[model samples]
Target: MRGTLLFDGRCGFCTRSRDLLARVDRHHRVETVPYQHPGTPDRYGLTEQQLARAVWWIDEAGTPRASAAEAANYALSAALGTTLPLRFYRLPGIRWLQEALYRWVSNNRQRLPGTTPWCEREPGTCG
Candidate 1:
């Protein structure tokens, strides 16, 4: 299934994850877009607040499909042809744990290694 993963470009952790995913996506099964790009939010029918909260995944038709860990796992599964982790992600308690961890990382990413001061700003406009 062809899909797109929209992510926070200004974020060091997210950008690094995007790059790693690109390598895993050898067959080009998914497209990765940075939400910081012009019109990205509008194109995906997402609000800035939504994009800021978590990564997003949309099918080729551009319908909003999932967010946070769900989106990341879907994109990874699509690219790597690995359904095992995807299955793990659906386990009720595991899903909760995954989302909580994802939120913590998202919330603390600016302080992560490789992060620049640009990502530390509110509404980080520069990357």
Candidate 2:
């Protein structure tokens, strides 16, 4: 696996997002795995709480790389064979904006399209 993408398997939106990534992963570089998979958190050295907060991408050796939007960026970049508007990471304020946007979307994911009524239910219920 070029990298492992740990996501919320139970979240409809997250699952859908993973599907989209797979569709574009012609070279199959990303290993998108749901954190709910047994022993996944331990394998990646991530806590359930951290996995709950956002998507995570770890390079092959299982080194923590990025989370949330940054993590997604890493996976997509690898998928398409081009780094995320990587220069943006160096631009003043751009990185902050990207992370902020991810937080907003994550915090309100239940309200986003593709999320079913059941997905809006109590915590674990959404999964």
Candidate 3:
């Protein structure tokens, strides 16, 4: 199944994360695109502010998955062709914890690795 991972292209941290995903994605089913790409956001029904806040996963059916942790799990599962992580993501309590962690990281992404001053100054316009 084909899918797209939408992210802020200008964010150093986000770009690096994309790179890591590319490297680990053995199935190559996921395509990473900057939200600023022409018509990308509109095609996926996403907004600049939403893309700036978190990563998104759009499936082959064009269904959007907006939760950061869920997106990651789905992408990784597609790459590995295994449902273990997906099962874990669906587990009670664990999903909530992962969501909280994802939110914390997304909220403070500028302070994370690969971030630059531009990430803090003009979030959605980097690329």
Best first by lDDT, ranked: 1, 2, 3
Cα deviation in Å at residue 93, candidate 2? Answer: 1.7
lDDT of 2 at 72: 86
TM-scores for all candidates: the values are 0.86, 0.84, 0.84
Model 2 lDDT tens row, 2-75: 68898887677787788789999999999887787778888778899999899999998889899998888888
Model 3's lDDT to the true fold? 0.77
lDDT (Cα, tens digit) per residue for candidate 1, span 19-79? 7889999999989877877788888889999998899999878898999999999998999
Candidate 2 off by > 4 Å:
115-127
Off by over 4 Å in 3: 115-127
Candidate 1 RMSD to the correct structure = 4.0
Candidate 1 structure, TM-score to reference: 0.86
Quick one: best TM-score, which candidate?
1
Cα lDDT computed for each candidate against the true fold: 0.83, 0.79, 0.77
How well is each residue in 27-114 modelled by candidate 3, as lDDT tens digits? 7888877777778768888777887778888888887875488888887777667778789999999999999999998888778997
